[model samples]
Target: MSSKTVKLLLVGIGGYGHFYIDGIEALADQVELVAIVDPFPAQALDWPTLQAQDIPCFDTLDAFLATGITVDLAVLASPISFHADQSCALMEAGVHVLCEKPIAATIPEVERMREVRDSTGKFLEIGYQWSFSEAVQNLKTDILSGHYGMAQCLSTHVAWPRTSAYYARNSWAGKIHNAQGAPVYDSPVANATAHFLHNMLFVLGETQQSSALPRKIRAECYRVNPIENYDTACLEVETEKGDRILFYTTHAADANDGPSFLYRFEGAEIRYEIGGDIVAYLADGSIKNYGNPEGTHMRKLDVCVAKVLDADGATTPICSIEAASSHTYCVNALQQIPVYTVDPAYLQVKEIKPGEQLTFIPNMGVHLREAFEQQKLFSEMNFPWATPMGAAVVVCPIHS
Candidate 1:
């Protein structure tokens, strides 16, 4: 660790890179930006800021590492295809990392990453922002403390609609694999509404640094958009202990709500919505509030920095790679199920303007809400358009 200040590396200066830039600037006093790794850095960062900071840009990670610049921490905002390679490379280069979510696209890549991190002795925290928030951490702490007794079942739903512009915003937004044949598995669950799904598995972990693995999962996928992957999904994952975790999410609906949850425990019921407080109401008439996960922007970055600087060697990033791999596990398992296309009868496209349009299914939100509330799949609700998951169960492998 750098005694005076942490030396940092920034990767991918576009898209979500803007958020990292803001966080870096806010914590400028405690850290120094050592290098910027991006093919074209100016897309998100202005020339003025770069010139003032005197930061050098590299066309690739290989080029930057060749310079032998010592970096204590590296924040990866790169694409999904590059995460496995880039994270392993940085950790092997003696840098702790904060890589963005879904961990990687496949279980094999995730296993490879875990191996490298273990061998290199560097910590890698996946950028599941909500997991690092005080609210989630406190909730997880309580869950581990047995204050909630046993988790009976959990359900989460997110309905964030996306336009053509969103999928067109990047080359890999809806792709299952990148052009390089690397697994990306980009979809609503893997990318956009991922935090919520991952949160369900995260808080139910047996320990602080580990998440519960899904022993079995059954899923149904559908796509209304002309993309490589499904735009909507509903699935049920069962833990080894046989507790149910249900998730329903979509980007192909007209409604935009949620990231809300209903987590049932033996002792209490937990409920939360985005931009609102998290409440756990117990059977004994006691209630606890866990604030809101969105209360802090880039709070994950701040916590990682504090972990590096704190004399407390035991302190670590709240969201470790192992804890995040469960999401990847769920993702890979979902790949086995076929992605069914929605019938055009339910599809409608509203042109926002020339060269822009929003596509959605009529009354899709209502169907999704019913499934989520009932902790049932669309097929179980007997929707005519829905298809059964049909014994498409997959068990996430326990690496141990």
Candidate 2:
């Protein structure tokens, strides 16, 4: 906390990094960009406006940190694998941090970063921007206020489409292994559907609970594409309170014409339909809609910054490393299940008319043979690279 204006640094200026530029412009009055770091030198060259402003841009974090620049906060949009090391370094340097979600690749990495934060006493906010959405905040207030009674069940669905070219665009997009264990950090729940899962967790107030943990998780996964990762999955999770959660995510289907994701409570529903707008329903049969606006994640980050600046030692409601770690675990659990293909015979059997003679086309055996052959082809092509060593469920001990 200083009397001077907040000076911020941007790290990893790639896809999401560019989106942060919009956020910076929105909050330009309160913050100034002192520096930017990206390995791709062309990224900075591509942005003439940012370049013309005389903002210092470097190709590496080591180079930027060596400049001895005085920055109050570091906005991390780096790759998922780099989060822990970069965050720990910034915290150790006495700069506050706003990091992207799935805080780190594993639970141990998350714990280490938390330890750094505790020792340095610097603010750390994991960027799960959906928590800051207007709809999410309203739902949280009502749920905590007992407006919905008790949350009996929760359901979340994320259905979007990604082509083979999408995975081919980046080397790490479909990987489960880098220098460390299985990158376990690819499509579906971990990337595309992450916000939906996080929103469900937020509305249910299932954040960082050590007493009532998820006791059981059963999952079914499918690999529709030729890649080495699952593109679709369905998960059923049971909490210690006996509450059930049904979570579904897929990147194989065609994009929906209407809303792509939805959240349902006992008496309320929130829709994030095709146009990117949000609508909520309450127990009183009232409806509220937030115009189909974009940059919702950026707004969440703004609130996160505000919370860190205003804290006198109270916990903030935004996502934390611990909560993000739990989410990573949830994704990992679902990925361990085997993929099953439906028999195709059920798809083509025609019904006979009352007066018509039945042509007994014995195609069931043929269809089963084709199904098994297709299954083998898929398994041989993908499973070798997709299967990771640590996909086993690791249940944390529940503390009273």
User: Judged by lDDT, which candidate is best?
Assistant: 1
Tens-place lDDT digits, model 2, residues 1-400: 5334568898976778887888888877677889988877465434678878888988878788898998878999887888888999998998888888767766667789989988988878877765656656665666666655666556655456565566655667756655466464575777766766656555665433211245566555556555666665556566656665656666654433222445555777656655556776777889877554344758755764565556564245356664566576666665556554323332222233343221111332232223222422222324322233212333332211
TM-score of each: 0.95, 0.77
Query: Which 10 residues in a row give candidate 2 its minimum summed lDDT?
Result: 356-365
Q: How many residue pairs clash in each candidate?
A: 0, 5
Model 1 lDDT, full chain set: 0.86
> For model 1, how does the per-residue alpha-carbon lDDT over 159-238 read when each residue is reduced to its tens digit?
99999999898788899888877788899999989998899999998888778888888888989899999999999999
lDDT over C-alpha atoms for residue 61 of model 1: 99
Q: How many angstroms is residue 46 displaced in model 2 relative to the true structure, after the best TM-score fit?
A: 4.9
**Best by the TM-score measure:** 1
TM-score of 1: 0.95
